[model samples]
Target: MSHDPSGHPAHLGRPGHSGHPGRPARIADVAALAGVSIGTASKALNDTGQLRTETRARVKAAAEQLGFVGDARARALSSGRSYTVGMVTTDSFGRFTMPVLLGAEDALSAGEVMVLVADTRDDHVREAHYLRSLVSRGVDGIIVTGRSADARPPIEVPVPVPVVYALTPSTSDADVSVTLDDAAGAAAAATHVLGLGRRRVAVVTGPVTARSAELRAAGARSVLGDRMTGEPLFGDWSERWGRRAVDQLDRTHGRVDAVVCGNDQIARGVCDRLRETGRSVPADVAVTGYDDWDVVALASRPPLTTVDMRLDELGRIAGRSLLELVAGGRPASTAVTPTLVVRESTAGA
Candidate 1:
């Protein structure tokens, strides 16, 4: 009998074999079971080419019945793709990367694509090594991401391949990036506070040097205008900073009716300090936060009214962009607009 490379009888993998005998099911067996040509079986299995829906379904059901799985090498040869994607991130903590990665996976999994994550921890050497490895493995595409919204240098790849940035944008305008519209989100928060008749608004946010901070402050400023109480209080992105900013606002801009915080942590801190100082939220001061981080926002004394950055949607768009690029289409950079989630903090006001 003819033998396979593994010294097994080749008949075990031949047509009409159910794979029950010491060997895995092959496409030939699936084609025989489905009563279709090998070519049609391949097209149906790979989800390529136009075919009658019922015919494809029958082929898939037959393959499933036989527990057939196509070989990676053969699939790659037929489709000219490894069916693998790589996600490289500097955010080892996964604070921002996780959501984006999950969203990208959601989009890619539909096409049977697999994602390989490489956490560089902001290390250039490690990132370069990961890039080289991914390229060598012949990944179909790559997605680059980071912890912050700042623009970073484009990742260098020796061979031309599709690369998309998520959350963190690439410095080169030519590269496709999907990111949050921080300014618009902050503006929405400010508008909501204003609509509640809280005119004396104060802004507390992250470092003045941060692009997100700058954009958020600008967005709030554009709306608050002369009604804004003093200038924005820029500090670190922390609860301590938030509490301190509240104290500062009390001393410098007393009796502010509302505060727009940089993040959920800051907003929670502001709420705590406000209560300690005997100020009732919504009644005395309405607070709004950026980044609707569930751990902080939902657990706050009065769940924060915050901007939902829609990070998952951003990642999904980034994934779609990479797919388009891989298909030889030039997809434009996308800026996902944030949505405001109203909760007890602002609902009472």
Candidate 2:
């Protein structure tokens, strides 16, 4: 048996492992294993200092082998940072916010940062309370999100830590935000139908009050031009609305070769209504949808060809932008273009 300078076993008889039995491993043990100074070991472990890349890797490897974990409280005290971030959302059901949160976690976890979630459920007073609480906790930054893709008022924080908007955007041009390009998504749908030799395309979408609905209509118009049968039929975001819109289209626009819907629910409803009336999907009238929601899209009779907003990617970008802001970098707001997912609905077309 060999002993270290302090009369402890130099090795625990395990490869790359060092430290005495019945005691937690420390930085001193890491330093000894890596043949580096204690200060150098810390610098490497914390990813600081101007140590050589190999030296840092060696120190980190040694630390990992010894299972040496740093004290978060001590690190926070020394760095003057909580190493935590907050995510505020108005999506109580987590339908939209959950994917964004998961994406943010993927990026933030790489930095060893923790996230605190605050769901305000669309109440201003509740939002204010959550903001205050997060600020008081000294979060390094924040990411604001919501169910809609529309712009909302920027959140006000007492301490003014970096904030990044995800899914939902900030109305202020000065604030950094990452959002879906609804118009582009609609345009993609239009282009796809056009490529399938579809003419007389009619648009069925949600209420005009929603920015997403307006943008989507405009996008389809931009691509379809005169091929678009008539003005968009705007109602509500529901399957019933979708079914009613189909009836309205039949009475007003006559026969449409393709129907571009605002969302999966609407597309599914359109397919169902068309089927009931002896119109075979794709064979007679091709249909496309926005928001590739699995439950709605996949559950449709022939499934749906829809737009994927890639919300998770948007959240990831938002998280990275927040990190940049916390590090004093000014990241410009960005809009992510949605991708088209082809399915059975547009299989023949």
Candidate 3:
């Protein structure tokens, strides 16, 4: 018969086997079978207390033998933590929030903590209600996330637990936050375009009042220096704006070699306009975009060389930071690094 390294028969803890027959095993059963008290069994399972290694091993063996699936409540009580986090976001169903939420969920779930998510829809009253509900349920901590990279007012929660912000940064320097580096993303796209031997690059993007648009325009200018074709064309974040900018650039600039857009949607419109104007992508005007939002980038003609926001990684870091804060560690604000996702759009010019 095969045995575990501990000299216990391997079959003892295998599935379809239980120390007590015909009933689900409980912590009490594990304790009774191991000749330890219920408290001791819990501490052993939780890796707490002053129990000897052999005694802890005995408890573990008993738990496996009884097939005891631990109760989260019992585990939480012993550890003085609920093993749960409240994920509150204002940008529900938006592309940005979804990735951050999923990333945070990934980290929390792996650490044996459950996530309870709620959308505030930018409603302060509703947000207050949800915050109270989460605290009342005894969540160990909370993660507040939203749609923009711009700093916003701090969430006021009376609870004595850590709060981590993602996507939308907290204006307060004291709070831990994980946010995107939009300038870096834009600069990366510019660097790639410049590398393709395309000078006289034109900028097309969202409204100048928007933080993202301003940052991206500044970043592109920073990289291109005097090589910039003209002033950035600011418009709404839409394909129509991209299309209109094409006509404007053609009429004014006369001979543009490249275009760097704020988002994939604009990039697609830019490519469409080039094709309509009998200009081949890469050959006529090398194009680049930001946000590597796959749907638009992949479907574009000849595809687009874009900058990936890497927001999933940002979310993961935010999740880890919340976990650390709950465990009494200090995690500082983090800026996610953006990388280039090269394709045929900027192949050459």
Looking at candidate 1, the ten consecutive residues that score lowest on lDDT are 5-14
lDDT per model, in order? 0.89, 0.89, 0.86
Clashing residue pairs in candidate 2, if any? Answer: none
- lDDT tens digits, residue span 68-176, model 1: 8779977686678998999999998387778899989998887778899999989999999999999998999999999999999999987988999999999999999
lDDT of 2 by residue, 178-256 (tens): 9989999999999999999998999999988999999999999999999999889999889888888889999999999
**Best-matching candidate per TM-score:** 3
Q: Arrange candidates, best TM-score first.
A: 3, 1, 2
Positional deviation of residue 197's Cα in model 1 after best superposition, in angstroms: 0.6
Query: Which digits, one per residue and each the tens of the lDDT, describe model 3 over residues 109-195?
Result: 899888999899999999999999988878999999988878889887776779999988999999998988888888888988888
Worst 10 residues of 2 by lDDT: 7-16
**Global Cα lDDT for candidate 2:** 0.89
TM-score of 1: 0.87
Clash count for each candidate, listed in order shown: 0, 0, 0
